[model samples]
Target chain A: MNNYERYMGMVKGEQVDYVPRIPILMHYAAKHIGASYADFAGDYNTLVKANIALAEDFGVSQLDIMSDPWRETADYGAEIEYLETTCPQCLKHPLEDSKDLSLLTRPEVGKTTRLTAAIKAIEAYKAYGYKEYSITGWVEGPAAEASDIRGVSNFMIDLIDDEEFACELMDLCVDVAIEFAKAQIAAGADTIGVGDAIASQMSADMYERLVFPREKRLVDGIHEAGGLVRLHICGNTNHILPVAASLGVDIIDCDWMVDVVKVRELFPKNTVIAGNLDPVEGIMESTPEKIHQNFIDLYHKVGNPYFVNAGCEVPMDTPKENLQALCKPIQYNSSI
Target chain B: MMDLKDLTEAIKTGNRTQATSLTQEALDADLTPQSILDAMVVGMDEIGDKFKRNEVFVPEMLIAARAMNESMAILEPSLVKSGYKPLATAVIGTVQGDLHDIGKNLVSMMWKGSALNVIDLGTNVTPDKFVAAIKEHDAKLVGLSALLTTTMPSMKATVEAIKSEELSDVKILIGGAPVTQSFADQIGADGYSPDAASAVDSAHQLLGIR
Candidate 1:
């Protein structure tokens, strides 16, 4: 079966020839194409070329239209500082003053430069006719998007002191995410990845009250748009695994700090689980033999309907052999 | 009936207005500025411990810190008038090639609440800048942060640059989502902290303050 067919089959709980590997490669991909991260993030052609080249070279199962988290916030007029080899930084938050919330309105997806660039990247991947590979479009999850728009420290305070305002802001972020996801879907993205790294920093109670409902809406919206969802929250999410599982996204990524055995216990059997590897130790610093062994142990713990990837973005300096080990197909007993 | 204890409670619960009012009332009641400051410390200590126990998370710690900051703004003039001095000077920033700073900012705030003079160099700080700040401030402690594995090398570079400046007397502390004790030792750092609250303890430990 083709890579896309294998990935979709696994997501659908069908038997697959082998597990699919869809590691999130950002700076690594940029370096693969001999381009600076600033160039990769700023130009859609750079991002698409880098991703396509990396996919071809590394045999990764997917190509993602993801460069940085600041894209959505940048479109909202937040000040961002692009770097030579690192992800772009959001220097100024748009909603620093609560009064700015009233003045803020969602930008049209196709009109905004960054968002349109992402959609165009998806279209370019489709034009390349790599039907065997899954093309992913990404959006910030509600809580993360809110944190992006409002500064992280300010948004954290807002959650406690002004729940109503937090919800209002989150709703607006979710609306933007829905529109963005739909636009990418229309641009031929087969799946959408929702990154809510900030949600993992909250307590289970806080996530349930403030973050989960909006995330649920984003997930449901993406599903309705006829695209699968990959929910990635970077950090130990053990406290909110159940709440995350209940969102009904096709895949839930567990960071390195999360217990894989507990993830299997908390998530339903059919749910496709991806990642719990310590990106630094399990990928960047390890030898090929060590990486292969780590994945073997991880797969045993996480069980089937599992995709292979690092807990977070693969570090830019990761050895090519380590990645090769990661992409190496597992030999499984068909009986199981 | 609103005493210093009320001020502590206000800060702990993140009631900014109550914290401000309680601080003002404490001053009006002729309470020592040190005592009021101590009350804020007590509140931060409680939140810090709760954070260590996972009973509280980032938002709770942030709001509580905000409350403490708000109260400190009212109490600072009195403390300065009474000749209060910060414990020590600390220079902190996220290392170069790393833009994530929430953790660094939290540590900076915790140090400030604990009465340490913090010189925040902000994010994407290079090694030369770190050494320059250390030399300029004659800082007793330098805290380096990096949230990305890719940036860990930058942390190492900063640590080496600072150490190479013949500031062996100055302690270096490192922390972030991807940092670890082994990595700290590997990079020849003086200390490592996993989170912001413990970062205060680590800072004190590094300086032989407590």
Candidate 2:
């Protein structure tokens, strides 16, 4: 089976020839193609070229529009500034100085914007896939999108002090994100990656009461749009793992800080857990042999329906040999 | 007639108004500014310890810190009038090519709560800027944060730059998502913190302070 089928089969609980690697590789992918990060996030052609190159090189399973988090925020009247060597920065948070819900109006999903570029990129992936590789479109989850527009500190304070405003803002974020996910699915994306890294830092009570329902709606919306869901939350998520898993997302990405063994305890045998490897120590700073061994051990520990990946995005300067070791195929083992 | 216990409880629960007013009440009751400050610090330390153990997360820590900050605003003028002095001065910033600063900002607030005088240099700070700030402030402690591995080399360069300046007394602490104790040792940082809560302990350990 091809990479796409392998991933889909894994998700569908069918036996795959081997586990598929789906490491989010934005900066590293751009570096592979010798393109500045500005070009990578700005032009969908560059974004697709880089992700495709990495997949060809490292046997990555998905072609994702994972350049940055500002795509959805851009549609919310935020001014994003692209840098040559780093992810684009949101120049001005639309709601930085205030919590005015009236300031937000949802953007038309297909209108010309960062997201438009992403949909075009998804179409390119579909054409290139020849109905094989999985094509991924991304959206900021409610909490992350709210953080992007309101600034992290401001949004955190809002979550504490003004629950009404925070929920309203997040509701709006989920609405825009659902329409954007649908547009991406219409553009031939087979998967929608929801990034809610902000939720990783939230209290279980706060996340459960406020963010989870909205995130559940977004995940449900994507599923309704006929797209698989990959939930990516960077950093330690020991607090909200249960609620996050209950969203019924197709895949849940575990960061390095998350104990995969513990994550396995929370998820069923058929659930797809992408990773729990430190991008720095486990892969980037490790030798090929050590990395190969690491992947082998993580695979066994995590059991079947697993994806080879770092806890987060592959670091920019990770050795190509180390990645080769990371993607080296391991025979499937059933946990059931 | 509410005592500093009420102030500590206020900060603990992140009740900013209560924290602020209780601190003022303590001062009005002829309680020493240092004692009132100590009460607020006790509240912060409780929150910090809870954060370290994962009992509380950033939002709660921030709210608690905000409570402490509002209380500090009321208590600061009195403390200055009473000739208060911070434990030591610190300089902190996110290394160049990294704009993410929530962790750095948290560390700064925690350091401030710990009674250290912190000068925040903000995000995307260059190595030369770090050295300049260290030299200018005569800071005895510095904290460097970098969320990106690409900026890690910049962190190493900053450490080397600071060392090259013969600032032996200036202890350097490094922390971020990608940083580790090994990375810290390799880059010659005096200490490393895995999270912001542990950052204060790392800084205190590096500087040989409580």
Candidate 3:
């Protein structure tokens, strides 16, 4: 079976020949393709070249691509500040001085400048995917995209201080994301990766009230569009794991703190958990032996229908041998 | 209603009012300034542990640190008037190419609350900057943070430069998303903290403070 088939089969609860490795590799991919982070996020051809290079170099089973977190905010007319080495950042909040959700315009999914470029990239990548390799198109999740548009500090205070406005902003962001996800699916993306690293920081109560429904809607929308959904929340999402699982997302991409065993306990029998390894300490700092043992430990905790990956994107400076040990399968007794 | 457990719990949950009130109550009950400081440190340390275990996160940590700071503002002069000495002086910063200062800032605040004299170098600091800070502060403990993987090497290089300096006696601590204990040893750093809170314990242990 090709990598795509194996991943799909595992997600479908079918037996797979081996575990799949879907580590998030953005900066690393850009590094592999020898492209600047600027070009990688701004230009579609640069992103495509880097991603294709990443797939070949890392032997990753899936192609998941995201154009920095600024895409949605930029479309909403936020000022984006691009650095030489790092990902572009949103400079001004679109909803900063004015908390008026009514003034917010929902940009057409296919017409927004760079977002259209992202959709085009998805189309091009999906057109050439191997039968077994899954093609992933990405969109910022409601909380993350909301933070981009309405500033993180403002959103936090608004959650308690201006509840109605926060919900309205969330709804607007979700509508745009759903339409974007649908466009990506129509463009041939077989899977949609939702980048919602910000939502992981919310309290369980706030999450259930403000963020959960919008995430559920986005996941449901992707499923309705005939595409699989993978949710990437890159922080300690332990408190919201149960609610996150209940959102019915096909796959949950965890970061360092969400233990795989805990995820297995919380999620339904068939739900696939991608990762929870400390990207920096475990893979970037540790030796080959340490990395190998860490993987073995993870495998022991994560049983069948689990993919091997770090909690977040692999660091650009991650030792090559350490990364190899992470993706390379190791033998472990399943009875643990 | 206001007691030590309540105070610690307040600090843990980042409840500033309860923490401040309980701290005052503890002081009113003829508790020593050292006792209040110990309790505050213990509470902040517990918050740190929970953070390291991923049971808590930045917002909670920030509030708890803020609460502890508020209490510390009330307790510091008392500790000094009674002739209490801080454990040590620590200089901390985020290495170059990394703009993430939240974790670094939190750690610095926690250190300050723990009664350590912390000289914060802020974010996007360079090796020469660290060396200069070390020399200027005469700091015994130097803490470095790097949120980006690409900047982690700068952390290692900073450590290397410090070790090569005349005062190799300075204890070095490293953190951020990419730093690990193994990497700490690889770079010859004196300690590695998993999170901002753990940095407190590691700093204390490295300095033999507690």
Give a tens-digit lDDT track for model 2, residues B63-147. Answer: 9888988888898899999998888999999998888888898899889878799999999998999999999999999999987
Task: Report the C-alpha displacement of residue A249, candidate 2, in angstroms.
Answer: 1.0
Error of 2 at B50 (Å): 1.7
RMSD of 3: 5.1
RMSD of each candidate relative to the true structure: 1.7, 1.9, 5.1
Candidate DockQ values, in order, are 0.70, 0.62, 0.22
List the lowest-lDDT window of 10 residues for candidate 1 chain B.
B1-10
Per-candidate count of clashing residue pairs (backbone under 3 Å): 0, 0, 5
Q: Report the lDDT tens digits of candidate 2 across residue range A136-204.
A: 888999999999999998899899899999999999989888988999899998889999988988789
Place model 3 in a CAPRI quality band: incorrect
TM-score of each model, paired residue for residue: 0.96, 0.95, 0.79
Regions more than 4 Å wrong, model 1: A332-336
Question: Clashing pairs in model 2?
Answer: none
Ranking of all candidate structures by their DockQ, best first: 1, 2, 3
Report the lDDT of model 1 for residue A145. Answer: 92
Q: Which candidate is the best by TM-score?
A: 1
Q: Please give, for residues A1-336, the per-residue lDDT of candidate 3 as tens digits.
A: 778877888788776676788887777777777889898888888888887776676677777667578887888888877765677866677887888776665666667777788887877787767455788888898888877787765565566556887888888888888898888888878889998877766678778878899999988999999988888887667889888878888888878767778888888878888886778777877788888787777777787677788878777888778877777755323343
State fnat for each of the candidate structures.
0.64, 0.58, 0.22
Give fnat for candidate 2. 0.58
